[model samples]
Target: MAILVLSVLVLLLSLYFRLKKRQKNDGLNKFPEGPSHPLLGHLPLMTSTTDVIDVSMQLIRNHGKTVKIRIGPKILPMRTSLLTADSHLTEFILSGNKILKKTENYQFLKHWLRKGLLISDGDYWKRHRKILTPAFHLEVLKEFVQVFESVGDVLIEKLRRCEGTPSCDLHPFVTLCTLDVICETAMGTKMNVQSGKNSHYVQSVKKTCRIIIERSMSTLKLTDTTFWLCRDFYTLKNELKVLHDFTHNVINSKKNNKSIDKNTKRLAFLDLLLKFSQDENILSTDEIREEVDTFMFAGHDTTASGICFTLYCLADHPEVQKQALQEQKDLFGDEKNPVITYPDLQNMKYLEQVIKESCRLYPPVPIIGRYTTEDTEFDGCLIPKYTNIMLFIYGLHRDPDYFPEPEKFKPERFDNFDGSLSYTYIPFSAGSRSCIGQKFAMLEMKSIISKIVRHFEIKPTSPRHEVKLSAETVLKSLNGIKVTLKKRP
Candidate 1:
């Protein structure tokens, strides 16, 4: 089987190279300005630093909105990518159903998540999504509000300990709290990350994410053989086992048991999948595990980054934080330990705008990619079937065309904002392939952020320019998001 797989891979490479050679010979036009090396092309440009998010953003400014980039080693011509900074072109690519298959790099995730919705394409993706869409529906997501607010209170209590501190790093607290929420919501298992007992589980998940990212950014490890030869490869496999076992154990615990409680009226994400396993489109154990992993990772990192950055924005703009607190105060007047209902979340309109602006300034996923399934034409250039289109979410959000003075945090941009940025401002991406968990993410972020801002006054030490960003599936601050906290008196 290995021999056959290798043989087929060699044949595919030959065919790909032949097609690319023909296109090169046609000699359409010039490539975008980038540090193209003699043999490595643009590989060295990004591989030199872990800060690819900032690097890619700067490249768009220097090389123009539509920039040509290259990744991977010298051998694979398929490593070349087009960085689309224009919102129209970005919309065009993400909006199309026929061309939305994620690039090959996403396959690297199968070790951790398997062929779940985040990576799978074609019929399988569509079918699985159909089964899972109801899990995130408005009514169903309402069921998880108690879960969100429960974790939110835990996070607030954790932050309360750091009150009156000179400066505190909020990301770690936010990450652990969100991790616990996802585990309970998806796996039906309480990970207790907020209490610090299950720090190992959190580390395993983070380590797995880091390994996947390091593999993507490494020029040598871009190829299967090169990655397999490295010591880190073994580390990734070992970490994968910890995470896989953690998730598998959850499934085993709930396989035969149908326990209902006072809080949960219906089955949660993983519970629903298991509940549906006896139907016509029965999900296998492997399928259930894949979906659980997909939701578990999605539910944890994206919202954590978002809430952290929203706090960063609040810390940066004191006036905005004041307004948010005022809004919260209006909702729950002098009632300490107030219940944050779903209706309260909806009424916090100004806070919602603040979250939108925060997402614009520091999006969770910096860059999203898709490979053309067939020859596609855009901006009067023919994009070959296998070419990589790196949609710069960071760049698109900050583009001057859609957003004037995009650098500044202006929550007013979304004030009475009639969803004009349907294509332009894609914090959760756009079109059919957009994140299904966006509502769930928003609920979690707003819940915790509202709680945090209400309890503590965040004071940012580092300005926006000082905090460095990197693309790690989720956007992260290299210098770390530093802020001082004072309990609201």
Candidate 2:
């Protein structure tokens, strides 16, 4: 009787897999196939590998640009995604208004960022985008240049401590500096993160980011119930409380404070939101917190990643660094620490090229996700509704057709380049849903990078460290971004 029961179970399991395989084949027949398991789909491929980015690149090379990857277990109602590095498909997806909803993976951020611009969709996203658009305008960004210069000064002083060291990991120092910049410019609150005054806030932010990434990757922690049972969930809960409390405190302080003269003080992004809240009454206090928190999250980490990678590239390539330094020297001749005004930042054209090239090689946000809201056709291939789409920005930037000799770091390639095209290089992404703070981010990066190049002669370590790139919430190096610095005389 026991043998008979076991035989029946085996037969049922076999039948289940067979049915699932057939359905998968029928559903994704139009798209190119990627390496996948019979029962687990592509989950095993991603989970088993430590080099996720490299593995993904290889998969794209083996398969076509647009390949269908099945996710989760076959026994359950799993997700099907079209992972595309194809520029045309990327343009089709990103340039369209019909598919603005983010994929389910972004749900992990909702607990922390709430329904801010990064995760919000439809009318809410549109409304918030409109309200926040003016905050990144030329006049507003010009006002923030002084903030960047002050933050850059702090960064230079911090790095000066490590000047004589054989090598130093710049990631931590750069991260803290960007954190300070975002807090001051976005919230009108000085976090003093660089000085270690708000260690709890900094740690909480880092912990929350790690938890979100881990939760997104873990199949076991994907569901709310399962996540609630995990140890990480508890840690994340505590960290989120710390983060939310900080944002709320800032909001409360801003609301009650009335001593500031509006004309003399530069308005922050938070100030703008408050003005909107008071005048139009379109945003609640919680909504204001959400936007502020969103800016804090989006603004800092991504820019830090960009700055670190650019510095690494500069250290690795001496000639490129020399050219960039020469441009800076030409601009601020004989001035050791010239004030980095908006025009000075704008005039550092070669430095801009170097930054752009580094971004091409290592985009901060390597992959961005969107889901189809309706059945869509791309290049004669029909995509069913509710399908997730992973736009491989890393792969798009490396497409040799658009960027010749893609592996080589050639800043000159961008001398006369037009990156405005939706399908081409999009480190900050493109189209209607593109990063609103692109201008602000670029200005900040230019200000910071130019300052570093002007004040220090950056060089690679004696052994030369190779960054092991990891595709996290943002692009990060598993090994630190190591470089040696000699203060310019």
User: Tens digits of per-residue lDDT for model 1 on 287-318?
Assistant: 99999999987778899899988998899899
Model 1, residue 257: displacement in angstroms? Answer: 1.1
Give, for candidate 1, the lowest lDDT window spanning 10 residues.
25-34
lDDT of prediction 2: 0.88
Give the best candidate by TM-score. Answer: 2
199: Cα error in model 2, Å? 0.6
lDDT tens digits, residues 1-489, model 2? 999999999999998898677566554577776667877788777862246688678878888787878866645437778788898888887888988999988999999999999999999999999999987879889989999988888999999988989998999999999999999999998888898899999999999998888887887788897898899989999999999999999889878889755554479999988887888999999999999999999999999999999999999999999998889879888686887777888888898899999999999999999988888777776788888989999988898878889999999988878655547888988788999999999999999998899899999998998998888889999888999999998
What's model 1's lDDT at 1? Answer: 100
